[model samples]
Target chain A: MENSPKIAANPEKYTFILFVSGMSVKSGHAIENLRSICDTYLKGNFNLQIIDITTDRQSAVDYQIIAIPTLIKTGPGQPRTLLGDLSDTEKVLRILDIKS
Target chain B: MFNYFHKKNQTGVRKIKPSKPQDEKFSFPKTPTGVEGLDEITDGGFPKGRPTLICGGAGCGKTLLSMQFLIKGITDFSEHGVFMSFEEPSKDLSLNVKSLGFDLDKLKAEKKLVVDYVRVERSEIEETGEYDLEGLFIRLNHAIDSVNAKRVVLDTIESLFAGLDNQAILRAELRRLFHWLKEKGVTAIITGERGEATLTRQGLEEYVSDCVIILDHRVIEQVSTRRLRIIKYRGSTHGTNEYPFLIDEDGISVLPITSLKLNNEVSSELVSTGVPGLDTMFVGGGFYRGSNILISGTAGTAKTTIACYFANEQCKKHEKTVFFAFEESPQQLIRNMKSIGIDLEKHIDKGLLQIHASRPSLNGLELHLLTLRKLIKDFKPTTVILDPISNLITVGNENEVRSMLVRLIDMLKANNITALFTSLNKQNDNLRPDLAEESVSSLVDTWITVRDMEGIGERNRGIFIVKSRGMGHSNQVREFVIGSKGIELLDVEFGPEGILTGAARKSNQLQRTVKAMKLQSDLDRKDREIDRKRKVLEANIAALKNEFESVVEELGILKATEDLHSKIMIENTPKTKKK
Candidate 1:
């Protein structure tokens, strides 16, 4: 588990950072929607990091996440930011440049 | 970095506990703008730890106002501030405000200020994917943290819109930016270009900021004036009128002239009207110390002369006076007063009197009031005189003039300064039907009417105390003469036709002298006739007495002759018969 074969094999996997307000309705919706989209589309090809802005304000400031439910594609060719709840799976996939 | 965040979070938790009560209504404490006459209109200042939008057209002093706010915050309240410009560079901004006497370079060197210039060029960059304004946030955060700023100004943030192509993203980012500033606990001023139908070009007022101020510059009758109005202030009450603001070498100053209330302290001390006879009209020596006196009359009725006398009297009492001459220049007024023996130049030379002469048409009514207010504040005069306030009627309507005079009088009363205004009435306006006079008459504590009494081939000036509030005043219409010795009220004259004056008085005196001479001659002739009659009657009485004496002598002689002829008995009988 600590050194999984997929993580070890994919050296240039997609890196994602999801910023959310703690336990909010919008944040909960965004987390569920993003998980289904990433799990179904990226399979075992992405690395995701979830940060709660209430607890990790420094990381939020570092990433410059102003609004809640912000998703950052850090490992992509160029960094892309998507705002609002990630309820639209097709739009999120296109914004993240991922294929199912 | 993780540990630093943990430490900061701990301190933040502690800070949040104490600030919870302030969050009930989300009522942010205010930060004083420190601009003259601005905080009064804003009811303290802009909201603290929140964004304030200042929108105006080009060259309306939006940047200057914001700069003054930031600089004054640092200098007056000891609160550090940061100015981030998206339009002009820091060097140009510093130079621009240098004329206003703001030493931005020195303040920066002292670590109390930071001016950051953010340059955005659309042609230099291409947008491909979704992104945030991280660069701007980082720059602003770094600048604020370096100076520990409590205030911030983003002058003309709409320039970013001009330089950026993504409107949806910029709008979202700006909303979040304002929230971010609130979270950072810094008072921020965001300036923008005014839109056709919105408060800002980007409709930034939709973001729900704490305050919104709109500046308007307009040219009326070939005179440009800048007016400021607070469209909205969330948590505090503010003045609602459009206040005229002026930008001079000292920066922007708003004149909240009508914001003053009528509850200022009043004085009971009396101040003479300078003309001794006029002072005798009031129950007190003259008007109340802080009272407003209006002298209304037609042209050449000595209205300015009376105002000059009042000002001269104040100066004579060692009290400072400010005389606003709207009709005549200072030198011209001095020359005219000299003819009436009012030496105003003497007081001016002694620094006890300040003469501010200007044409009423030079600017709008508000500008005139503002100039007067500035002069009064700087001179700290105990008395103020506005000669021919009627001239101001040309600049504004009746309502505007009334409100302006009300404010002027209220300010003088608040400062415990005596004020006298001379108004010109129309020719033959004996009923005092002038609109300006009618409007301000109720606001004055004393009202005097001077008119021309044209009768019997001569025109004489008559002064009457129309009303004196809270005191008894003379009701007699005293005819006054303006000569080399100033104004002197003549004694009341009475004739069959009523109060006599001019030629009628002279003719009445002549008629009285003729009647007295005719009465003296008639009495002397009657005395001579009575003396002649008494002399004739005395002569007749004397003559009768002589006859009686002679008859008695004859009777005595006949009795002696009869006594020789033995007629002693007959003589005794004749004597008995005579008895």
Candidate 2:
């Protein structure tokens, strides 16, 4: 819902913002994949926010988003952006520097 | 953003209302770019509401051209624009265009322009699975709607190919992007880097088929020139020739006038050649207004002098004049002309004349022509003079110089500016067959040649009109002197050596006067001798008549003596005979 990912309230809390187009099959898979990965890896230690760019398109511009299902992990290290449906959970974790 | 495209697909409806019925039947709608000479080449401008691909190599002015289009649209046509830069950020773009006098910041503040910097960093991005460019569409739509922009510029959209992965998905997304832009109904320009094989690196020309413009920067010898060409404009007829364009402080100006047709309007009005005698040589007393006149000559044959005279004459008439002096600086030209009594400095001070002097090697021939074209446009001169166009030949080969001259002459003629060009030929070369003369002589309305007429070990300047189209020009070569009083064409003289000039002419005149004087004295001596002979004969006849009278008197006396004894000789002798 937020245009920018909020600063982690707790310094160690993993924060992620996922941007997607409205109701597309790829976007649906990306949302489910990210939730499952966060649940399995960090359990209740992470905050996840999902935004449909079709509705909050202004957020997409502010975030410099180009591809759909883009996930930005802003925590534990420098922020990193991930593209596509996030179906390759291992590749997404490797890019975000998350050991799972 | 998805709904916008989805709604259009479901209804198969165009977001833009169809153009006026008659307009649709006649011609496709066009949005004028308002760039100088570009609207003429496009035959109006880019196709309205369609994507146009502008491709060129790096530093070939592709971005500047697109920026000019957007700025000109807003400033000239009052249409707002959105600039989506895949290369430079908004701050950098503003700084770059500010040098060209385009205040992008001001335009943004006024809500007339929106610059969206789309940064796609490869290091920060990870491809997981299937994805589309819906985010780009969303950002572009938001920017366009914010300003209600009618024009959009996606400068070098090829940068996306570098940032994104998966060619199939990217290609499909690009297709959808173009379609979405069409639905938005804004005239859009998509710039691409030139490809080795295709028009664009990503072959963007394949997607944007409505119009394709290519910009080329070529360096011949050591000079570089920028040229523009319209490869295609689907529904409109456009000028397909490669036109030289200039990027100065004012932005991109394409020189689109290469008049292939000889159908320019002719003026019977005469513009003096500045030299009265030269004007008189043309039966009409001067050149036809708007006609091209070429004066080819050997070095020091007063070619520049004649050109200056023409410029001075135009300025005297209070008409503007632009003198492109290739050989001499303005100060030097003004000083040189002053020696011949032509005070060009005054005309310059009066703002009636502009002397632009540049080295021929400073720029390519195309740049020279572009510069001249710009000067003519700004000055709007009634007369234009290029002192020694031969210098331009040094920068380019014969064909290039000829083509440039063709464009230049056409531009001048179209503007109805009387054009005079001076060409310097080699010292011993025939003036007719040299580079400048051979190329431009045929295209000009008047071709005048000045040469060193060498006679009796002295050289004299002689001028003659080689050809004058549609006028009765003198077929005589008149000797001219460049005295302190300017160019004075002497009366045509035919001597024993034929068409004598200068010192030779003066010597021949003296010889003629001496011969005439000798003949006059010889006639006087012959008349005195004849009068003496007639007086002597008259005296001899008078003496013979007196002798006859005396003899008759003696005979009468003798007859009277005998006739007193014989009736005075006869009468007395006759009376004696009767007694």
Candidate 3:
């Protein structure tokens, strides 16, 4: 028998608002990274709403997010912010203190 | 081994592409499943450009996992998916997951996904020689192209084997089917029935596949463990252990507990155990949030009470709760519990609780599981209760309930929701619920037992903590009494007599017999008090008699003095003074 994966569903309320600049390398990586983080780290209690500058570049400025791959914790806790592509699972999971 | 890049968009269209091509790069593309533990087990997700086999025994969470993977892909990854089921109808799947809040039908209508259910009955079709899954391929391609799909799922393709008797032709066709799917170059999940000698009966899938995930449900002693393992994954470093998996309303969850990594970071706050006495027994005085508790007891021993107490505790906390009453009717159960003072009416009215009571006989074991799964999916309760899953024996006997409980546990654990369950044991001498029969005990993080121990000429209902996975707990059976204040537990009285019972109990009834038995000190005090009262009465009588005698003497003196002449005046005066 193979060992099982440690999978858990999150209970805290959370949503993510992403500010991306166009569908560039960083933008695509950011979306994938955010999704992967949510899948492996956040499970289902979190949602991600993306603002793509590909068509609506002005909308990114409205959120005042200076970085291209900025993640805003929209719903839960004190305003937690993560900058850069969400490729770091451990850091992201730690920042959120996700239930292990 | 996968790299994804977004397309440079001139207008509004979004393009999704993988950095590594199928043949040019040996690195396998991964389809990340949005489910927590599943991605870890698969080392990312299902194989990106090949058919991943998910073979399992009946009621082993095959369909659910595939659906979860598909839904996660479409909604999270922007990779449109096509769900082609060979067993269940699209309507049933939609209805089943409606509780989970996944509107697959809506996803299909949105042109982002496709749900096609193909019905095949062996009795209906007669096959000659050559057979092809060409129709399924065409339908799948159409659905995929419509959404520019990246994911596809075929549930229980073994239906084709049972439908067609030409074993050689079916085997050949099954091989061809996987080949064609691989040619499609889209991540696909193919569910199959467990074969007697292998992961799949056809045996062709494991021979030529990018990945093979096997799901199994088995009873080890009395505990049923539903395990999922990566039998083979060609190009990825996948977890090799047989991970325990659960299928509930929110779908399949594989708990990858490879170690005893304890986290004291548990919520320091306490939540009541529903039973006042039980909560008081805890040092923190309650169970932590997301705790899994088991109440095991013989029939008529109030396992249901413990569950009710747990639910009541949650309602008191002002948290929403979902009660899956598989044994009793909501009204019948509520009315019966009124005798014990468990008033669920107010909680239901307050919108803090939802009671979903149903007869296990109403559906097959899977349907019942699906319904519970749906309830949790839709209700999203902080706590869930299953009253006497032992009654679920009517649905699938032992094997089915065990499997169902395994899934049920996984679902609750994954959601971080506290779950309370009551399991009935028919035999008095059993240590646990016919756990072998139901096989659910081992999966619980905590176990509580309630039993009717013959004592005090009646029955002494006692509840004891058998085990707790993490926190330290007491191992004493406290006397459980149902009062207006809810269930109260009496302190466990320990002495040389062990547990008091029957005539011994009667003899030790000091409160009732104290008046009957006169103690020496009390008797002595009563005698002294009586003696003192008698002496005082005697003294008073004697004084009255003396006074009367003195008066008579004085009168006699006065008469004598009067007879002797006026000289008696002095004597009369003297006699009067004496009187």
- Stretches off by above 4 angstroms in model 1 are A1-100, B1-28, B123-125, B257-260, B428-432, B515-579
TM-score of each predicted structure versus truth: 0.73, 0.86, 0.51
Sort the candidates on TM-score, descending order. Answer: 2, 1, 3
Q: What is the alpha-carbon interface RMSD for each candidate?
A: 7.3, 0.9, 24.5
Q: Supply the TM-score for candidate 1.
A: 0.73
Q: Which ten residues in a row have the lowest lDDT in candidate 3 chain A?
A: A1-10
Clashing pairs in 2: B559-B568, B559-B569, B560-B568, B562-B566, B563-B566, B563-B567, B563-B568, B566-B572, B567-B572
Sorted on DockQ, best first, the list reads: 2, 1, 3
Better of 2 and 3 by TM-score: 2
- Candidate 3 regions with alpha-carbon error over 4 angstroms: A1-100, B1-27, B33-41, B51-75, B80-209, B212-231, B238-265, B274-284, B360-378, B392-416, B429-447, B455-457, B464-507, B510-579
Model 2: runs farther than 4 Å from truth? A1-11, B1-25, B429-432, B522-579
lDDT of 1 by residue, B449-541 (tens): 999988756899999998999899988888888888888987778889788888887787788789889988988888888888899999989
lDDT, residue B141, model 1? 78
Error of 1 at B553 (Å): 29
Query: In what order do the candidates fall by lDDT, top score first?
Result: 2, 1, 3
Model 3 chain B lowest lDDT segment of ten: B1-10
